[model samples]
Each structure stands twice: as structure tokens, then as C-alpha cells.
Target: MMYKMQFPKIVLIIIITSTLAVNEIRFYPVEAIPDIKKVPEEYPTIQAAINAASPGDTIIVTHGTYNENLLVNKSISIIGENPATTIIDGGQRGNAINVVSSGVVISGFTIQNGTGGLPYSGISVSGCNFVVINNTVLRENYYGLQLTNSNNSQIFNNVIMNNMYAGIYIHDRCSNNAFFENTIKNNIVGVWSSNSPSNVFYHNNFINNTNQLQAFPPMILDNGSEGNYWSDCIGSDIDLDGVGDAPFAGDRYPLMGMFVNFTLRYGSQIYFLSIICNSTISNFHFDRSNGKISFDVLGSKDTVGFCRMASPLTIIKNYTVYINDKVPIYIGNWTVSNYIYGYFLYLHESEPQRVTVMLDLPKNENPQSLFPILVATLLIVTALTIIILIKRKGKLDKNLS
Candidate 1:
């Protein structure tokens, strides 16, 4: 009888442990803030919507042509409905859009017709830590996008063409800004900077521009990966490694093609193959044509690692993982499912490492299946708790008799 009572209590502990282990594995999804205001629906003009919006609010503009300059003084997202159909015409005024506050995001619009000079721009950002992406800044009287005294900003995926001066101008000691994947074409100068140190440029295509780059002080043109592509880079890839031989003096690894892809696998289940370098990981996808999954990575001489904690649904008995076609040094114990698996890698000759997982499974484990298992374990724990309490009460009544 004593053994029978102890059996229920032991079962209760096991069920509780299983339930806790399953609940501990969590995936962090990037949260999207809902749009609080819409232009022409909530307010008549774009500037009016901005005036009525509070900080962290998103103001989405519909597809139409609006002839007015915008001044953003708060942290908000001014998103256009479509990049081609949505237009913000400055009408030869000072600037198309001037951002004076930080943490602003301007995307999906065609900003044009600015008449102002040096300090004035199509999109002038005096604020730090902003994002200007997925826009077309064309026919500017001065600079297309100017960054003055701004630090830690990102300017990416924009088509900056037909500008009279530089496509992008960084000045006044602006540091740690990243310019990537932009098409700076048909401008007088692609990128011109003065006194701006530690700015990074990568993967941009400078096509048909009169001058490529003009700098007063030296900047980090490349981060040891393939730098921006120049139309006049007369270099040739003899070994066909997708890196140029030597047309531009400063660009050590000039890309032979427009883009490059890498492969990564997460412990038995997740795989990101043919992915672009330095991208973000959002999902486990196999097809790159669908363009659904990516990872945020960097390539350099320093060592780096990729880590993921195994969920309770995954059984980690004997796992084989590869990084850059080489086996990784596994550093943690894997007796249970809630263990962390990590692969430490050292860069070899300025290239990103590839990671792959080798799994010989009868069927792939589903991460979603853990929920039902957790529910069943919770029910078992509740049932065993009642059994243990009844057994103790019977023993007490026998002692009293």
C-alpha cells in the first residue's frame, strides 16, 4: 500500500516535469504595430495626419499624387500604398521630406522635385537611427538623400536616380550608417561624403553614374565581403569565385554577379538554403523563389556561431550538424529536448560559413505537436495529484480506527 501511494506521487512529478519542459521553448515573433492613422481617410493631407499622430503611430498614405513638403517631428512610420503609384512631389520647394526626429521609417513612395541645395534634400535626415527604404528619389535639385549629424541609420533598397549632385551625401561626422542594396544610377555622383567616418557600404549597384564615389575622409568601403558593384569595375574573376580580380583598387571582393546566396540549417527541422548573406531568419523555408525565409548574418575574420534551443517535441539522441561543410564542435549536453545546440565558426578568407543539420528520422518532428503533448501531461498531473491525496486520506482514517 505504501508502494502504491508512492507510485502516484512519482508519476505526478514526471508529468509536471514534462509539462514544464514543453512550455519553456518559445519562439519570438517580430511584432507589427497596427496603423493608427490613414491619410486622406483620417486626415486630408499627409502632413495633417502626421500632425494628428502621436509617437509610435503608423500613418499609411494611399496611392495618389500629393504636392506638399512633409516635416516629421515625431517617431512614426510614413508608409505609402505603393512605390510606383504613390507620389510625393515637392513642387520645387525646399525638400520633399525632412525628418527631424529619430526612429522614423519612410518607405514605398516616389519622392521628387526638390529645388533646395546642400542642406536641403529630397529626404534630409538630421535625426539619428532612422530607416529610409524601398523608395525612389529622383530628379532632385540637390542631393537625393542627405544625412547630417545622424548616427546609426540605415539607407537601403532605394532607387536614387537622375539627381544633379550626389545620390547620397553623408556629412558632419555621421558615423555607423549602413548603405546596402541600393541602385544609385544616372546621378552625377553616386555617393559623396565629407568628414563621415565608419560608414559601411555593401551590395549597392552604382550604374551609369558620372562619378562613383567622392570622399574627403576615408571610409570603410567594404566589410571584407563583396562590396558595391560599379559599372566601371573592369575586374575579372579568373577563378570564378564571384569576386573580382582587380579593376577597382579599394574593392577587394567585388561581386561578379548581382547577388550571392548561402545555405543554413537549424537542428533537424529548419533549413534556409540559397539565402542571401547578412539576411534575417524568419522561418524554415526551402524555396528561395518564394522568398519567405532569411537570416541576419555577417562575414569577417572574427569567429561567429549560430545557436538554437531544441524544443520539447524534438528528440535529440545523436545529431550530426555541419558548418561550412565541416563538422562543428558541439558544446552542450543533449540528454533532454530542452538543450541548446551551438556551432562556433571561424571565418576563412572573408567568407560566410554555411551551416547544415543531418537528421536521419523516420518522420520529421513538428514543433506544433508539443501543444497537445503538453495538454495531456497536464491532465495526467492533475489525475495523479488526486490519487495521491486519496491514498493519504485512507491511511489517516486507518490510523484513527
Candidate 2:
């Protein structure tokens, strides 16, 4: 016999579950801020309204220019009416908007003319996981936008142009950030990374920049960059397919050549040698397709009895090699060394020594010559003399007994 459930108890449980679900889906509207305390109709500044806002409130900026450097240090959303009309100028001294607190969203405003020395930026989000979307950052004194040690941030649909350094720089422990659909142009570098990793970059257009993207110290393993349009790509499609026939080499850290040239005196020499050696041994290539750039690296060694060089070596085929790419290719060992001293020649001469080398044997050590027979006879006579001396000594001792 099954026990029957009470009808009132079942009805009470259903009512409680419905109420809990409704509470879980709560919506806070922009009007909620005005309800807590009525904002003055004619406030002098937007910062005053932000200071008066409570947690989870929205501060809507009217369609006008607010020449003030605002700081939002609370969990709130500051939405501007129009990105073009609503301008937030920093008087060229501090950040236009600094989001210090978490869960802040700054959308639909043009943040411009943020002036400071090197570290200051147009829109700086420090220690905050914020959404910076649909904004324009122009003529920043330093970086256009900078995220420091922040995680899970989204920077999308922003037009960042003419910045002094990188358009967007995510540096020093920033992780899991997403930069998508932004037009980053006319900056020193479109995007730069010092120690940041595990970030996703997609559908972004980098045009007319000195350098497109840069990553320092190189991404070793489990870290990669892909699926972004670069204007400087020059590979071809022989198959008429949209994708490139080959992938680009050194996509992630391709700026090493530029870095070396700027910093060292003889950096070009090193780069030329490196390219020749890598091309011969590694078969690396740089590919661009659908505006996305990436590197295609070849597999490990397959040749037996031949030890692979620690670094790559230059191998020229078909055409005569030139020293035009003027880089040194140093060949050596840990204890002793020899250099490949001459430049590559395109001579048509039929000199066999130019291609190979043969060793000459010493006359005393030649096994197939008459010197070996004479040496063997001398050794046999010397062995007989020693044996006879030993036998005579034994006979003399026996006679004396």
C-alpha cells in the first residue's frame, strides 16, 4: 500500500519554487538611480551623478560634451546617449574614464585626449573586469586603452587610432581577455603583449600601422594567436582557393627582427643568417587567408646518422647564393670550431674538389704497400731471438745441478 501525499503540502511546495525563480531573474533598470534620490535636473557635472549613484545603478549621460575626467569606483553602468555627440575629454592630463571597481560598464562615448607620460592611457581599467564597447578612443597621449592585471574583460567595436604606442596593451598578468571587431590603426603597434597570454583575438582589422602585433619572450607551448586580419600579409594562392598556399612563419613573435634592428648595431646580419638556416632545415612559411595570419612549422628530423644542428644552417639550391641579406651564419662546436669562410659562388667551373674531399694515407701505415711486408718480417725475427735466450738460460741451470 502506497502512502498518499497531502494536497496542501504539494501546493505549498509549488508556490515556493515559483517565487524563488522569479527572485533569481531580477532586472535593474536605469530609472532605479533616480528613484533612490532624485538627481537634480541641472547638475553641473556627470561625476556628481556618479557619486550619488548606489550599487547596481545606471548613470545615463545626456547628449552633450562633459569636459571632465570621471572615475567610476563602483559597480554600475554608465551609458552615454550617443558615442559621437557625448564626448568625455580628459583635458590631456588623466584618463577620460578610470574604472577601478569591478562589474563596471562604459559604453557609447568617445574618450579622447587623455594626456600623461608613458603609463597613462585614454581609458584605463585597473583591477576591474569591465565591458568597453562601442567607444572611440582617439589621439591618446600614450596608449589608447590599457588593461593591467585584469581578467575576463571585453574590448569590442571600438575605433582606436593615432595613439603614441600600442592601440591596446594588455600587460603584466592579464589573462582570458577578448579583443574582437576593433579597428586599431595608425599606432606604433596595433596590439602589444609583454607577459599576457591565453587571450583570444578575432575579426579585428589592423591597417597602416608600423607593426601589427607583437609578443615578447615568445609563446612556447599551449599558447597561440590566430584568426585576425592583417594588412601586411603578401602570400599568394596558386590553387585559386581563398586560403593561402602556405602559412606565415613567426606570426606570434615576428617582431624579433624589428626589435633587433632597433636595439643592436649588427642585428640585420643575425636576421639574414637565421632566415637562411631556418629555410634550409625547418621549411617554415608565413600564410595569410581570409585576412587571418598564422605560422606553419615543419616536423622534426627524419634523416639518420646526421645530427641536426642546434640552430638552422643556410642551404641554397639552383640559383647562386648572395650575401645581400648580409647576416652571419656561425658554425662551431663547444670545444673547437671552424667557420664557413667564403661567400656562395655561382661559378660554372668543373672542379671536383669544390664539391668533395678525400683523405691521403701515410706510407708507414699503408697496409697494401711493401712497407707492411718489411715491418712484419722484422717483428717475427725479434720474437724468435727472445724465445732462444729464455731456452738457453733454462739448459744452463739444469747442467749446473
Candidate 3:
């Protein structure tokens, strides 16, 4: 009928519509209960409990022997009450715990006696991410823990021992894994990795196993091993700083020939005398002058007076030369019957008369007693004869005038 409504009635109608809209949308209280889905303890098996649980559920295993293989098909937390008491026996068939899905936590349990005829393991993790295996004991399996095509896994503080193949086998594109503070011992290979890279293995004691460690040889050729400890090193810490004095060249097959030859001949005493003589002889120098060769020994004591030459003097051999009072020079090569010590100077010339050689002795030494005294005595006699003749001629001229 196109009739106008009052202002108060319009405001009242708006308020009623807003209230209806608010009431139409459901409102629950702040302290409301979540959709709790409980897993019963009477499920009689861990697998039955897992089937009934959803994605974000925890399957708790009580203290008993669950002699069944577990396959985690979804993201779930499988916790055991006490690892030392909870046993997941594989009945000598497939893997005891196979995680096919990601984000799974399998902690605090003893996984043992698992067997697959062709190289299966106690726990086989495939294509999984963010998986944690902690405080777990894996023993007596073909492989303790086999990680294949997995990434970003944490394996810490676990004891993996007495396995058939390898204690920890990371294979086929597994990377970014942390293997820390674990006791891995008594296996065929403690840790085996084929073509895996960028992995951290630190602060782990690898002790007294049959084969403590091994890696793919070809992969090591491309990616080198850095900062690893070997239990078989026998070398000195020369600098007293805990590192080796020489670089530890690892078990490279190509260098075995050189190492064998070096070890066999390195400590032999055949060259001992030669090494000593070479060290002594390198300290002296030789020079020749005026039909006389002089040896200017830099640090020889003044007790050196005469020099002696000894033999088979093939330039420098056991060519012992001595210095006492006079310098002895040899013109030609000679073999001596006796051994002489100290410096011996030698000069060689075809015409010995063309050069004169003189030996200057120390001032304290008496030239009269030295063997070269003959030449000095002859010069004094010639001077006395010339002086007597000159005085006699002067007296004869005075008498004749």
C-alpha cells in the first residue's frame, strides 16, 4: 500500500536483522573440547591401533613383545613406554620398522632379530623427510639402519652394534643428515656411504671394529675426505700442538709402490759416512795462486801450523789435508800411505820454476827452527860475502896513493 514507516520502527528492524545474522552463525565457547579421538588399549596389536588412529595420533606400545613388523603408512608418532622393555621382533622376515611416510618419530625401542634374505635391515627408511631415530638400540640384523633416498634425518645417541653388513648404511641420494654421538662398532663396516656427499660425521668414537670405516673409492676421488681421524696413525706431534707434522696421505692404492720403496731404503746405514763427510766438506772453499794453493779455512784454530796432504786425492774424497806450521802444496795427484787431518793446500803447474811460493808463519814461531830455514841461512851468507869484498877494495886504494 506504499505506506511510510516510522524512524523508531526502522531502527528496531535493523537491530533485529543484525542479531539474527549473528545468531545464525554458530558460536562455541573459548573452553570448548576438541574433537578427541581416543585409541583403546584393548586393540591387541600395534597395527590395529594404527588403523583406528588418524594422521595426528600417537600409538603407544605397552611393555610387551610385539612380535609383528610395523609399517608406518602415515604421519604419526610411535612411542614406546620403555625402550629396554619394548621389543619389536621381525620374526626373521621383513624389516621390523619400515617408514614409508614422512614426519615419523620412532624412538625408544629395541629393534632386534630382523632378517630379509637379500639385504634388508632392522629399520628401513625410504623417501622420508624429517625422521628421527633416537635412543634406539639396533642389533643382530643384516643392516642396523638402512636409509635409502631419504633426506634431512637426525640419528643421534643410538647404539648400533653387531650387524652383518653395516651399522649405518646411507645410500642412493641421501644427504643433509646428522650422525652424532653414537657408538657404532663390531660390524663389517661401521659406516658405509656410496656417492653420498655433504654429510657431517663428527665427535664419534669409532673403536676396535673389524673394518672401522670405508667409502666409495670413486666418489672419494671427486669429493675428498676432510678432517677425519684414523685409529692407525703412528707419527709424532712435532710442534706439540696435537696435529701431525706431515700430512696423512690416506689409503690410496696408486701411491703404494712409492711408499714401499721409500720405507725399505730410508733407514739403511750405507750412506751414513757419506752424509757426514758431505756436511763437513761443504763448509770449506778452495783457491789456487802462484804455484801454491792456499786454503782459507774460515773457523780453523791457530793450532794449525803445518799442512799434510793424503791421498787417492780424486779432487775430493777421503782427501784429508792438515795445517800445522807450513803450508803444503801438491803439484800432482798422489796417494798417501797414512791418514792426515786438517787443511792441505795443493797447486799444480807444468813449469814449476815460473812461480815462487812463500809461506808466512806466525810471529811467535822461530823461522830458524822451521824446515824452510835452509833458504834463510843461504841469503845471510851471501850478504856477508858482499860486504867483506867492498871494505877490502877501499883499503887497497888508500895504500897505492
Candidate 4:
């Protein structure tokens, strides 16, 4: 449905923030929070909508090839209909989208073809704070995304590859920013953060870059126990924790394989989890009633197939990992802050297998749960039998009378 909306921002008490409780996080999904103003339908171009929008308004662009250099000076969200189909070509002139305002969000678009220099980028955020660039594809540009004097932003789940100079260039006091679950590959430099520090990177897959990183010290490359996956890293996971023992590409606790971010939604709510695995995952199912989460993972026989999951404690806890109803090797579990991070080794010998993580119900188990069902069935059968006997008795009495 297309909506040409200009609704004012609604102020709800108990506002959601990055520091909200994990349970409270799922209550407010990202899609439900913003007032949408459709592009092309409402306005001809994305830049036009930005020009007409209020500070907190959201501009949703439908799937089409839009060739323009957008300059976003106001705080708003520019979301595409679909990332694979939505194209924002810069035409090799300027940055595809230049964000100079704080609290800006650009998601779900294929932004490409910026001029080949540090000044031009697919998406450039300058002097902005609390910005988010996610679920977008940035390729064939000078720099996929560049941050200049930006602070406290979250960049995740982006495919940034095949750029000329660098996939991402961060400099000039970009602090407290996080880059996670992004696949940065096939560039001259994957990440060129020369003077930037105090930012943390985890769960990202940096693959096949000519120069993987040019980061300075005091920059965190891991989340203490688990870090990113480097394609050139030759370290081994001796303890089978899905993490490398030695440092690789400036990451201390490098991951074993690519980090996959799955948006496993339950009903109206969506749950996000990061999984590092060598196998292909599919059919993610979640049952909050039973506290059970299941998915399938398939891998080659030669590769060590494993799924390392990290999520909030409210999502999955006290759970036993199973593969095809059989138990996989319990690698380990680590509690990091409000999240529960776990690793399991499930090798299927070139076959596909289901991986199930069933949380132990606080009060109910299998036999006890079955007892209630059996009792309910018995009571219903008994009631039917009494009804039949009463009918028979009434019919006989009526006949005799």
C-alpha cells in the first residue's frame, strides 16, 4: 500500500532507545514507528520528498531506477521498497546520498556510481550523530560509505563491495560507531579508518579485499569474546567455539565463517539474531508459546558445519541445541551483558539437518504437558458418554409412558 502521509510525530511515553530492555525492544518494530511519505507517488524524486518533509517524517521510495544526487539536510528516513529492486544511481557525479543531519536513516536501496575520490561516496554522512545505514547495497562507487566527523551511529547488515578506493572510509573523530553484520569485499581497502577510533566492529564478514584494514590502535575489533570473520585469516578454532585463537586483520577474536543476520519475525514482532556459520540456514521457525526456535543448516562434508548464535537473554535461554532431533556437540555458552551467546558443532556429513534450540519451560515439561492434554481428552469423552446415556434413558421413558 502506498501512503502519501504528512502526519505529525506522535509522542508516546516510555520511548524506545538503544538502552531499552531486551523485552521492550521487540515491542516496537522499526516499521511501525514512522510516518511514511511515498516517493514518485507523492513527490517525483526522493530529494523532493525531503524538501517537503518535516524533520521526523519518513520518505519511502518504491522500486524504480532513480538517478539523482540527493542532499539530505533534514533528519528523516529514506527507505526503499526493496533493496534488490530499488536503484539510486549517482551517475558518477556526486555522492548518491549525502547525510548532513543527525537522526537520519537510509535503508533498503542499491546506492551506486559515485565519482572516484574520497570526497564522493555512495552514501556519505558528515557531522551527523545517531544515524543508521542498514539493509542497503552499496557498490561500484569510490567509497561505499564514508563517515566524516560522525558520532554514535550504527551501520549494519549492509553489502558494501566492488568499490574503487575503499568500501568504507571513516575518519575525523568518528566515535562510538558500530559496524556489524556487514559484508565488505572486493575493494582496494575494505575499511580505511586512519584516524578514527573508539568504534567497535563485530559479526561482519570482510572478504577478498586487497588491503583488509588500515585502522589505528585503541579501535575495538571484537565484542570481547567474539569478533568479525576475516576471509584471509588463517587462524584455527582449536576449542570449536567458532572463533579463532589468534588475531586476524586487526580482530582479536575473529570468527570462523561469515556472519549472517537473520530477521526471524514472530507474529507482529520481529526478532534479530546474529549467526556465524559455514552452512546455509533456512526455515527459521519460532514458537514463543513453547519457547522453541528451530532452523535448518546444510553444509559440505569437507567443511566443518557449525552455527554460532548470539542473542538477547529474553529471546533464547536455558535452551538445549539439537540437530535432527539428535543432540549436537554443545560447544559452549557465554553470557555477555544482557545477551546469551552460544556455539554448537553440528556436522551432518554432507546432508541437511534441522537445528533446534528448545528453551526449558519454567514450569512445564513434556510428560507433564502431555498429562493435561490426556486429562482433557478423557473428560470430553466422559461427557459425551453421559450425554448419550441420558438421551437413551429419556427415549426409553418416553416410549414407556
Top candidate (TM-score): 4
What's the C-alpha lDDT at position 206 in model 2? 69
Q: Weakest 10 consecutive residues, lDDT, candidate 1? A: 272-281
Which pairs clash in model 3? 305-324, 305-325, 306-323, 306-324, 306-325, 307-322, 321-342, 321-343, 322-342
Tens digits of per-residue lDDT for model 4, 23-103: 234454356354679989989998899999888899989999999999999889899989999999999988988899999
Backbone atom clashes (below 3 Å) for every candidate: 8, 9, 9, 0
Deviation in angstroms for 280 in model 2?
Answer: 40
Candidate 2: deviation at residue 305, Å? 52
**How far in Å is the alpha carbon of 163 misplaced in model 4?**
1.4
Worst 10 residues of 4 by lDDT: 1-10
- Where model 1 places Cα greater than 4 Å from the true spot, the runs are 1-35, 116-119, 130-141, 247-249, 260-401
For residues 1-401, what per-residue lDDT tens digits would candidate 1 score against the true structure? Answer: 67665876777677776766566766888876555798888899999999988888899899999998999999898999988888898877788888899988998888887665434578888856755555554556478888889988888778898887888888998989998778788989988999997898887777788998888776776667567677787666554334577647366666544433224343345432222222223333333232223222344455433333232223333345555566655423243334323223333335444545443332435766667677776777777776778789889978999
Tens-place lDDT digits, model 3, residues 154-234: 887677888888988888888777775566778888888876765666434354457766666322211121122334444
Provide the RMSD of all predictions against the true structure, rounded to 1 decimal: 12.0, 30.4, 40.7, 12.3
Ranking under lDDT, best-scoring first?
4, 1, 3, 2
Worst 10 residues of 2 by lDDT: 256-265
lDDT winner: 4
Give lDDT: candidate 3, residue 14: 50
| Candidate 3 off by > 4 Å | 1-42, 217-401
Relative to the unseen true structure, what is the C-alpha lDDT of residue 345 in candidate 3, on a scale of 0 to 100? Answer: 35
